[model samples]
Target: MATFSLLVTANPHSSQGQFSAIQFAKTLISQGHILKRVFFYADGVLVASRLNCPPSDEYNLTKTWAKLAIEHDFELVACVTVAMKRGITNAAEAERNALTGDNLDPAFEISGLGQLTEAMLESDRLVTFG
Candidate 1:
């Protein structure tokens, strides 16, 4: 099975890119492929925001993605630069920044762009969604 890396570059609440990426990841895994990592860039980092809440009837994109990551061992890496600029800090970052609290989902992680580069270099395929 081929190893795959995914880059999700869209805002979860503004477009369908996140949903499409989720489906693609699921399909690849179900087909017995290996998923290396899912890199969240730009506004895509919003998917790691614990503050995200859709209407009761609407899909909870953030939670869905988190659940997928938890069920599988795949990494959900959110770009720290983008997340900080957008105020999506984790517990340590929030404390350091004197923010009220952290809202980053537990299933996601904050990291640098180097992780994205690593995924590209190490994986057999790199798929982007935006």
Candidate 2:
């Protein structure tokens, strides 16, 4: 199985892009593939927001991603710049920006663009969902 670096650039709940990405990632892992990172960029930053609360009967994309990341031991990295622009700050960023709260999910991390570059370099395949 090959190593993959998945990039997601769609809103988690508004469309099927995020759902497809998650399903593909699961398939890869189930098939014995290695996922290096799941990078959230553009509108995809919404996938990492801790404040995302879908309807009771709906599937929670953020929670699904979190559980998969933990279960698979893969990195779920949200683009720091995009996340900040969308107000999806973690504790450190919120403190630096003087925000009253932070909402980035604990399952994911905020990182620079270099991490994305490195993921591509290390991965055998780069998959994008946008």
Alpha-carbon deviation at 45 in model 1, angstroms: 0.6
What is model 1's C-alpha RMSD?
0.8
The best candidate by TM-score is 2
User: TM-scores for all candidates?
Assistant: 0.97, 0.98
Clash pairs for candidate 1: none
Candidates in order have lDDT scores of: 0.93, 0.94
Where is the poorest 10-residue window by lDDT in model 1?
A: 65-74
Per-residue accuracy of model 2 over 7-50 as CA lDDT, tens digit each: 99988767889999999999999999999899999999988988
- The candidate 2 region of ten consecutive residues with least summed lDDT is 10-19
Residue 17 shift from truth in candidate 2, angstroms: 0.7
Scored against the true structure, residue 109 in model 1 reaches a CA lDDT of 93
